[model samples]
Target: MNSVSTDLIIQSIYETLYMVSVSLLIGTLIGVPLGILLVITRANGIKPKRIFFTLLNGVINIVRSVPFIILLVAITPLTRLIAGQTYGSTAAIVPLVVYIAPFIARLVENSVLEVGPGIIELAKSLGASTFQTIRYFLMPEALGSLVLTMTTATIGLIGATAMAGTIGGGGIGSLAITYGYERFNTFVIILTVIILIIIVQIIQGIGNRLAKKLRHE
Candidate 1:
């Protein structure tokens, strides 16, 4: 039983990583652009478009407001369509991406907003194109903050993946439910909690280091 428990725990860690990493990658790719658009379409943005911003903002808000567990079940059909049968770690990535993308977008928007208005004005005064300003000035200035934002989003993804496990999306969460709770194995529950803590600490530590490095550079 000890050997089996160890093997299950190890496999669960890999499954959790698989879901979180792929979801985070896709979410960041889509969310970052959406976030940039959100910022640049606002009243004081580089090219304000009130109607467009309002619609987009509404969509983002609606999606983000939904709880992850509800979203997971709500999107199961879509997930099946995408992954050709939902349940495993790969299938779980579909909803995880959907759940995290808007969150990442909002985080990114806030990060970019932290870049001062003065810097934007300075870029404008120099006749910088919108792309040039964002690429050179805004994004670079906010890189450190963005790193922290990604870290926060990644942490959220971790939690979401655990919830995904309830629906046969195998991970440490499923292990906890099956072995820890169902079988009344306190050791398994304790181990799962410790493992989760270790993963979070590692992610945070790396994010902190990267943010510090970017800020210094």
Candidate 2:
């Protein structure tokens, strides 16, 4: 490959990172609160509201049911409105954030649910307020599991970033699709795959270590 190709690959990598990280940050901000509400609004939750819980839960489910690619196309107009266009890394983030926010909400709901009922009782016994109970007891107890869930979310974001490339989102995935598959350039495909593997490994390893540390604490 020429120096130009090498530079393109590096730039693609940066674009992928930019999309994934920005979406993850924004998604996490939206998702974590929704997850907390899902837990705290159920029938048995601290502040049960049957109608609200049911409605919120349904919306999350409906979004999750749609496939990511379809969601990408379906939200193109909104993407254009938010990102000011329907293509490229910045525009890609609108759909990516939309896709991952509810996904992270579900993951967070499951992770937070894994905290035992006993912990809730303990918090009550200590006279912790609703916010205090969640902040001090549930969150602390589920911290380790939440870390793992976020790790899974991160990896999922990476895959979605590649898919975003199909629509001119521009990343290693686009490079592979344009040069590797379309032009039958085996090297780009292999290189992209290897780079993705290395990225996933690094994320998983960090998650494991962080979870272990939280567990020890």
Candidate 3:
């Protein structure tokens, strides 16, 4: 490829990263807390409630049930409202955040559930309030899983960004679609695949290392 093509590819990667980071950040801001709430309010948990758990579970299921492509199209209006346009990396974040947050929430809920009930009871026996228990015990104990889940979510968002590219959101995937598939440019398609594979490998490696460190702690 020419230098100009290389430059464009690099720029597209950076734009893709920006979209993924913003979406993941926003998703985590909302999802982690909701996960905690789901854990704490379950019937067997500290602040047990049947109705609330059912409602939260239903909401999560509904969000998860929607396919990402459909959600991407459905949120175009909201994306345009927030981004002032819905056909670029910046515009892609709106649906990406909405798509990943509930999955992250469920990951967190599962991780928190893995914590021993005895640990929770011990926190209570020490007179720890609900907030304290979660803050001191649940979160700390689940930090490793949290890191892994975030890693997984980040990778998922990368795929979402590729789909966003089909709607004119510029990325390697968009380049592949417009130049590779349409024009039958096999080289661009192959190169884009290589770049994506490298990105996924790096993310997974970092996540595994972090999770291992957290486990040792």
Candidate 4:
């Protein structure tokens, strides 16, 4: 029984890592730029455009507001289209990306916002182009915060991957449900929780150390 449980745990861990890493990489590609755009085009921003900002902000808010489980069920068509099936770790990446992109955008937006406005002023005084302003003054200043923000996003993805198991997403959460819940296997449930906690702790520890180093340097 212990050997069987170990095998299930190992497979689930791989699936969870696959779903989270792939989805997060894709989400970051979309979200980070979107976040920079949100800051650059907002009211009093480097390139403020009221209509553009409002439209973009509204769209992000709409997506971000929906619960993940609903988002999972709601985007089944998209999942099938992208993954060619709707019941595995790969299929789960679609909704996970959709879910995390806006979330990462918001967190990134906040991180960039926390940068001192004086940096913007300094950039302007130096005749920096908008691109230069963001590249040099804004992003560098906010990078440490961005690291922490990404850490939070990564942790969120872990939980979401577990949740993704609900739809046969094939991760730790699926193991818990299939054996722990259905078969009343207390040991599996406890082990799954412990594994998740350890993963979270490692991610958080790395994030904190990196962020601190970034900030110090």
Candidate 5:
């Protein structure tokens, strides 16, 4: 109820947002291309390369299998090297991106795969190059699904940020643990949960509307 508590809550919100936004941006940059590659290199893909696809798929699977908390500790050295520290919001982004990128990549691959085979065959029949087919056909046809995929990935990242907070990665999760659980302040815990829920709802609403619009177009 005090000004100090309010300020801490506000700061935590900002920290969470910063970590989530940056991680999402970087993950998207890396994951989208990785996803496309996964699809295109599969056995039935336009340019199938079984060996390469198997290697890539294995790596993604291995990363996704590691629990986030363990991954946080496991990658501490790398995070410290990259962010100059292994704690706080910035350092948290390293692990967050590592964890989320493959997640997003899988989502993207699934989304792109949902595109009709007939459509892809049509593009190929017209002598469209791989790049041209992806750019003009696959991507356009899958835009709505891609938006939904990104939205799902973003929500997952938000949850990861909270877990990051448990390990000195400051955010509402840290706040909840320190004040709500540790100090036995139910109000703080409730408030933080409410804020996170509201954020997720807003994101879902926006993503749904955007995807609807794109689909209509």
Candidate 6:
């Protein structure tokens, strides 16, 4: 029984990792630039654009406002179009990306904003173009905060994805909800919690180390 439980734990952890990885990859690709745009086009930003900012901000808010579970069910057609099915880890990735992308975008925008306006001003004084400022000054200085943001976003998304399991997305959460909770299996419930905790700790530790490494001050 112990061996079997161990096997299940390993499998669930792997699925969780898969969901996290895919969501992070896709989210970062979309979110980072969206975040940069948010920062750059704000009222006091380097290239302020009132209408653009308002439109983009509204879109981000709309995405962020929807709950993950409902988002999961709501995007079933999209999930099916992308993954060819609306149940399992692959299908879950769609909603996971949809949910986490806006969150990550906001996180990254805030982190970049926190880098202080002086850095951008310095770059501009040095005859740097807007692109050059972002490429060299902003991104490099904000690296530490970005790492922390990504770490936090990744962990938060993992928890959200686990909830996706309750809707047929495969992971430790699905295992806990479907088999453990529904069947009233104490062993499975405890095991799922242990695995989720371990994974979160590992991710948090790595993120902290990376953030420290990126810090120049």
Please, what are the lDDT tens digits per residue for candidate 1 over residues 16-129?
A: 999899999999999999999999999999989999999999999999999998999999899999998787788898999999999999999999999999999999999999
User: lDDT of all the models against the reference?
Assistant: 0.91, 0.91, 0.88, 0.92, 0.92, 0.88
- TM-scores of all candidate predictions against the true structure: 0.96, 0.96, 0.94, 0.96, 0.97, 0.95
In model 5, which runs have C-alpha deviations exceeding 4 angstroms? 2-4
Stretches off by above 4 angstroms in model 6 are 2-4
Ranking by TM-score: 5, 4, 2, 1, 6, 3
- C-alpha root-mean-square deviation, each candidate: 1.4, 1.4, 1.7, 1.3, 1.3, 1.6
The Cα RMSD of model 6 versus the native structure comes to: 1.6
List model 4 lDDT by residue over 106-193, tens digit each.
Answer: 9999999998888899999999999999998999999999999999999999988877987888898778777787788898888888
lDDT-better candidate, 3 vs 4: 4
Can you write out model 3's per-residue Cα lDDT over 101-207, one digit (the tens) per residue?
A: 99899999999999998999899899999989999999999999989999999998888888888677777667767777778878888888888899989999999
**lDDT score for candidate 6 against the true structure:** 0.88
Question: Model 1 scores what on Cα lDDT?
Answer: 0.91
Question: How would you encode candidate 6's per-residue C-alpha lDDT over 122-163 as one tens digit per residue?
Answer: 998999998998999999988999999999998998789779
Evaluate model 2: give its TM-score.
0.96
Candidate 5 per-residue lDDT, tens place, 90-144, comes to 9999999999999999999999999999998999899999999999999999899
Q: After superposition, how far is residue 170 of candidate 2 from its true place, in Å?
A: 1.1
C-alpha lDDT of residue 199 in model 4:
93
Put down candidate 2 lDDT per residue, 16-114, tens digits, no spaces. 999999999999999999999999999999889999999999999999999889999999999988888997899999999999999999999999999
RMSD, model 1, all Cα superposed?
1.4
